[model samples]
Target: MAERRVFITGTAGFIGFHLARLLLAEGFRVHGYDGMTDYYDVRLKQRRHAMLAQSESFTATEARLEDMDTLQRTVEAFRPDIIVHLAAQAGVRYSLEQPRTYIEANIVGTFNVMECARAVPVQHLLMASTSSVYGANEEMPFRETDKADTPLTIYAASKKATEAMGHSYAHIYGLPTTLFRFFTVYGPWGRPDMALFKFTRGILEGTPIDIYNHGDMWRDFTYVDDLVRGIRLLIDAVPPLPEARGGSVPGANVPGDSLSPAAPFRIVNIGNSDRVRLLDFVDAIEAEIGRKAIRNYLPMQAGDVPATWADASLIHALTGFRPATPFREGVARFVAWYRDYYGR
Candidate 1:
């Protein structure tokens, strides 16, 4: 692994930053590419990049993923053995106002990454998907084999489209591909638009935090470190080619596997597998910060779900790992970091 080179997109993003740091510590050379868009605070992204830059094995390029020329050039130059595509226009509600950004960034940008990966024939290609794609599915725990045909928001549709695109590329080019459906991920260095960050900030500043769905929401809140650890392990668990697996059989080799019968591709859910109530999450934040929150109850937001639960069995079956971080413990850690980082 010391000599291995990895090309990862969205290294400045929350999960990407943690994944890159883990790989760098394991002696893997990492090249990070991010647009550093003002979707949130550019300073947060910059600070993540700056910390990554401290590592000698880490180098980065600040460019949009939609810039095929730049993305292609960086991939070809780095000659990475693996590529993890994590950059995208993320946020469900924002997709309602700026739907085109989701189409441009998530759709076109992902296509560019696929083209580059196919051209390189890397050992593996991993990309981030979201539980949002499981839109309108009322299942308790979403499995990889579940049919996700209904997408409530443009953000969900864009991700579902990419999954199909990824499957096609994997089948047509024999590229080993893995798409991870991430649940509600939070921790220190989390995106400001996310619930945990907003709630923490609101509580500390004595502001009212919005509780959508009348605080009846539930989410599989995954810790950032745990989520990234799953990505790191999956890197080496590359899906095998069909011929190697006795002529392409989905679920033939592994029970409950979502392995495509025609391609060396599969989808895995990366989450805590523990559903947490929104009110409980908010309470955890308040408890950690040692303050009472001014709660603002609101109806469900458009493009929002009442709950999201991930069946993380496939990830464990594939890599013998599971996200086991307790929500309260993780919340405490983030609260400490938040207080320290912002001097709150």
Candidate 2:
């Protein structure tokens, strides 16, 4: 068999960086496309791209997802067997302030990717969604089949929109599509905007860290490597069209699978399946940093959910894997990287 080629968007972003590295290590020739926006820190994005550049099999294109021509050209030249779309203007609070950015990047940008994929027709198209789509739901653990109709923020809405668009493309064009909803992913090379990164920085600098909802929140904080491992495994678990399965569901052997009946599409949740309290997460950071943070308790901000937990059995059923990294161990690994990277 020939080596597989993968084209991954947002290769300079947190999850994308890790996924591309994992694929490259496994001998996959990868083409990475990233805008390298200054949403958080362009330097961090540059550093991630630089590290991946060390691999001879990794090639990167620096361009925005809204640039349809560039995206289409890059995908055409790469001729990837699989395409993983992860680029977006991400953040719940930021979405409230800049909803148009989310529309352009998440909506229009995703449309551009789908168009390119349609033209080239990859074997599988896997895109990233979010647990935030389960907004306003009081369910203990969100399943892929759960009705995610109440998206609190534009960020979640934009992701939901992409999922809908992906389904249509799969139904109309027979594209094999998988939309994976991720939980709170944290580890080394994490986005500075995320809670873990902000808290670690504030603790190290002896500054105040905002504990939202008075530290009452709970999250299924998945480790970055573990999250990417699930992704790597799911790459091979492509959804089959209903017709291809003789009008039977592909994963009917396993219960609670989110395989679509009308299209070759599925939605899977990639999470740790263990919810950790915000205060306990802080404790893990304090232990790793050897210092206590100045905690600033505040009301829950708008467009924020009190908790997010994922029922990852669907992903496990399909790929025979689930994210299992504990929050403490993942935090320790992230803090060690923080200290070394910043020369603390």
Candidate 3:
């Protein structure tokens, strides 16, 4: 068999970096595209790209996703067997301030990617969604089959819109698409804006760490490695077209399956099945760093939900895997990497 090639956007981003590394190790030829946005630290993104460049099979282009001409040229040049659209304007809170960026990057940019996928008609097209899309729901664990129409912020709304776009393309073009809704993912090489990085920095710098919602928050925190592994396995579990499955159903009989009866598309939630409290998460960071955070309790910010849990059973059914990293262990590993990376 020829070597499988993957064209993945946002390779310099946290999850993208990990996923690219995993696929490279598995002998997949990967072409990465990233905007190298200043949303976080550009230097951090550069370092990630530099690391991936060490592999001969890994190549990258630094450009924004909204640049359709360049994006189309790059994708056409790569001729990938699979395309994973992971680049977007991230951050739920940031979306409240810069709503237009979300529209350009998340909505317009995603549409461009889907168009490319439709043209190439790859074996599979996997895109990223978020658990934040399950906003305002009073449910304990969010299943893929659950309604995700209550996106509170433009960031969540953008991802939700992309899910719809993907489904439409799948239905019309017979594209095999999978959109995975990720929960709170943290680990080494995480974004500086996430809670773990912010809390660790504040603690080490002797600054105050803001505990949101007065420490009443809960998250289904997933480790980056486990999350990427789920992604790697899911690449091959392409949803079959309804007619292609012939007489019977491929995933219809499976309970909790989010496969659309009209198209070769499905939505899966990738998250740790366990939800941990915000205070307990901070405690774990303190335990790992041997320094206590100067806590400043505050009300939940706008567009913030009190808790998010995922029913990850569908991923398990499709790929025979579930994220199992304990949040405490994940936090400790992150702190260790932070110390080594920053010499703190």
In candidate 1 the C-alpha lDDT for residue 249 amounts to 43
lDDT of 1: 0.93
lDDT of 3 by residue, 196-223 (tens): 9999999999999999999999999999
- Write down the RMSD of all candidates, one decimal each: 1.7, 1.2, 1.1
How high is the CA lDDT of each candidate model?
0.93, 0.93, 0.94
Residues 224-301, candidate 2: write the lDDT tens digits. Answer: 999999999989988887777744555544578788889989999999999899999999999989999999999999
* Residue 292, model 2: Cα distance from true site in angstroms: 0.8
Clashes of each: 0, 0, 0
Instruction: Candidate 2: count the clashes.
Output: 0
- Compute each candidate's TM-score over C-alphas: 0.98, 0.98, 0.98
Instruction: List the candidate 2 regions with Cα displacement exceeding 4 Å.
Output: 246-252
- In candidate 3 the C-alpha lDDT for residue 58 amounts to 99
Question: Lowest-lDDT window of 10 residues in candidate 3?
Answer: 246-255
